[model samples]
Target: MKTYTRITLSLLTILSLSACKNEEITPNRGKVKFETVSISSKLAGRIEKIYVQEGQLVKQGDTLALIDIPEVNAKLIQAEGAITSAQGQLDMAFNGATSEQLSQIDGQLNAAKAQMDFAQESFNRLQNMFQDSLVSQQQFDEVKMKLSMAKAQVSGLQAKRDEVTKGTRFEQIEQAKGQLDRAQGAKQEVLLAADERYVIAPTDMSIETISLEEGELLTPGYALFNGYKTNGVYFRFTIPESRIYDYNVGNTLTIMNPYTKDETQAKIIAIKQLAQYADITSTSPLYELSESIYELKVVPTSDISGQKFFNNATVLIKK
Candidate 1:
């Protein structure tokens, strides 16, 4: 009877010890979470098209939507016309007066020359008459004045003709050319703005949320879509502040998805210096943290396919 009692006591103690050992071996597991960001529109216009739907996977530079660009196109065309007109004016200014204009100025100059010659001959005859006392000094003086006026008119006409024959000044031509170039540049800028109406995907991203739809008038800075990288989803988890001293960058970790029973091996890429506290009332459960927890970034060593890891999903980590 004594032996039997001793055996029974030993068995009970062993069982209790086993239970304590089991409790000690079980690790502290925490839920997995993801970070999200929202993408917004850069320009304001009507949504002409939406190329992506909710949960659609997209690569970088993919067109997401387009704005109505008819107005922009019209402005570009108008600018182009203005540029053409400016260019033609610039060309004319640079080329100077045409042959026909020069010819007309030349004829006027020749007529002035003929008038001056006739006046000079008359003045010479008057001078001879005055010297011989055949005509009065006042008559000779009148003829001399006529000759001087004709000579001055001829000189003025010759200068005017020379000006017409000379091509446009270099400075004036350059100014006109610059105006035309500016107009052309304005047209190009409008075209570029029109092209910007179409929104494009950034790269290798999955569309998480779509806010706008076709034909909707979107204002500037409107929320368009939310996206995440598709290659490998990052698992955001936190470690207890007590154990933070033991963990460092490049530390290996094991993560398990409790929902899917999927396991992934990862490494500690970063340890957030600041502590994250709980916001219990918020709808987002992942960001809500308990006190004494520090945020951590873990990148999976392997790929996860078709598995939806819930925010705050349980992960079994073996450090």
Candidate 2:
């Protein structure tokens, strides 16, 4: 009987020592977090209005603020004018010359022909006079030059008449069409710039801040840090190297919501060794001097859905 009692005491002592060792390294809960994104304007502008306050829920493409881009408005006006002018030029190319213009050109050509005839008759008379020694060589040459000038004028007028009647050349029409296309493209570009006037949410998130007040300038690449996405809720747990053996990339664990006391099964999505010490946001940071830490990314399983989790909220991980 004494031997039996001694064996039972030894077993209890071993169990007690094991319990104490496990207690020295307790499992920790990570924070419920959603990815944060920066909200910014592609074009720099002054804020016209703020539509949201801090902590407001917004969906993707929702207008958070309005920016007044003075340059964009002016560009739109210029683009529209260019489009109108290009359209007019294209129409002129297609329609050719008007009836009045054709009639005027024909009249000029007829006048040129009359002058040519009169000059030819005088030249013939001068030729005869020269042959009879009735006029100087200079006089004959003067009449000959007048006839040539009249003939050249008639030819020029005839060419002008043909061009007016034949409409615009193929090259001219193609050039006009290209100009119209260019104008339309410019107008589209201006409209896209105008769209940048609204500061928009990139995803479904809660507003974390409003960096600028009304009438203040907002430069490019500024972060509004719209709070984490609601639908893409996930938890990030920082586990020190001492306790990292409990988790891998695909391990499943039950996470308890500290606020609601509700438990949800989550699967580990990713595991990464944190490089920076300042990035550690672990519950029970286990402030060791120089030991490396790791981060475990987890998401709720499909069987557990529809839970609204808040950012940085405590969630116990059951490893």
Whole-model lDDT values for every prediction: 0.78, 0.85
> Residues 67-105, candidate 1, lDDT per residue (tens digit)?
875678788888989899998889888778888988888
Best model number under lDDT: 2
Error of 1 at 172 (Å): 3.1
Q: How close to the true structure is residue 237 of candidate 2, measured as C-alpha lDDT?
A: 88
Q: In model 2, where do residues sit more than 4 Å from their true spots? A: 1-28, 115-152, 241-247, 258-260, 276-291, 303-308
> In model 2, what is the error at residue 223, expressed in angstroms?
3.2
Cα TM-score per model: 0.67, 0.75
Full-model lDDT, candidate 2: 0.85
